[model samples]
Target: MDQEASYGFAPTEFEERVARAQRLMGQHRLDGLLLTSMDNIRYFIGVDSTFWESYTRPWFVLIPATGAPLAIIPEIGRAIIEKTWVKEIRSWPSPRPEDEGTSLVVEAISGLPRRHGRVGAELG
Candidate 1:
């Protein structure tokens, strides 16, 4: 799809949401948040893609305690994500079941500055 047209929330709105989440994370002593679901990802980064309905691959966005989120996604979705405000993105070729960006995810998580060494993820 053409990402030429901007989509989703204003950049400031997304920034405010991240700030609120970070404040909450500080109260809970969390170092970061790793989100995988489409809803949560959209809520934070404004990526709304019907392609996500396929479920053939995974998508991730890592929101550290005090900065912009990093989108870890499949290469196919890069164009869509680029239209959003997020500036840092990492992608890998999709459908490689043997790897499927697991290593990249690990690397992204490991690179965070963690005082609590605790990362929150969507569960249940």
Candidate 2:
């Protein structure tokens, strides 16, 4: 079975969702979106995993204004994230209190077109 088939959503569906989100972002004059919640990540990238139950590592996904979504996650979830629609996957060793995925998140955000840009985050 193919990855998408197993995930229960076609790649096109994921692309459509990204397009819709980008359209909304543009309309709102938002530069990008930073998603930290597991549900939000799954909705954008089709990454379904129970590993999120472990709080040792944090996962994030960044959707730029005009390009593909980026996944900044732990090395443990690399394989699963790879199977998702997202192509840019940045990973690091988890449970590292010193850094964790903070550097990667910064790097991803810095790549956005605008400096000191308005990024929407899921707060709830």
On a 0 to 100 scale, what is the lDDT of residue 39 in model 2?
86
Q: Please give the TM-score that candidate 1 achieves against the real structure.
A: 0.92
Segments of candidate 2 deviating more than 4 angstroms: none
Estimated TM-score for each candidate: 0.92, 0.92
lDDT per residue for candidate 1 within 11-122, as digits (tens), equals 6788898999999999999989999999999999887997677677888899998788899988999998888888998999888888767898899989999799899999
- Lowest summed lDDT across 10 adjacent residues in model 2 is found at 2-11
Which pairs, if any, clash in model 2?
none
Task: Please estimate how well model 2 matches the true structure, expressed as its whole-model Cα lDDT.
Answer: 0.86
Cα lDDT tens digits, model 2, 12-107, are 899899999999999888889999888888888877898776777888999988899999988999999878888889998887899879899988
- Give the root-mean-square deviation of each candidate in angstroms: 2.5, 1.6
lDDT at residue 104 of model 1 (Cα atoms): 87
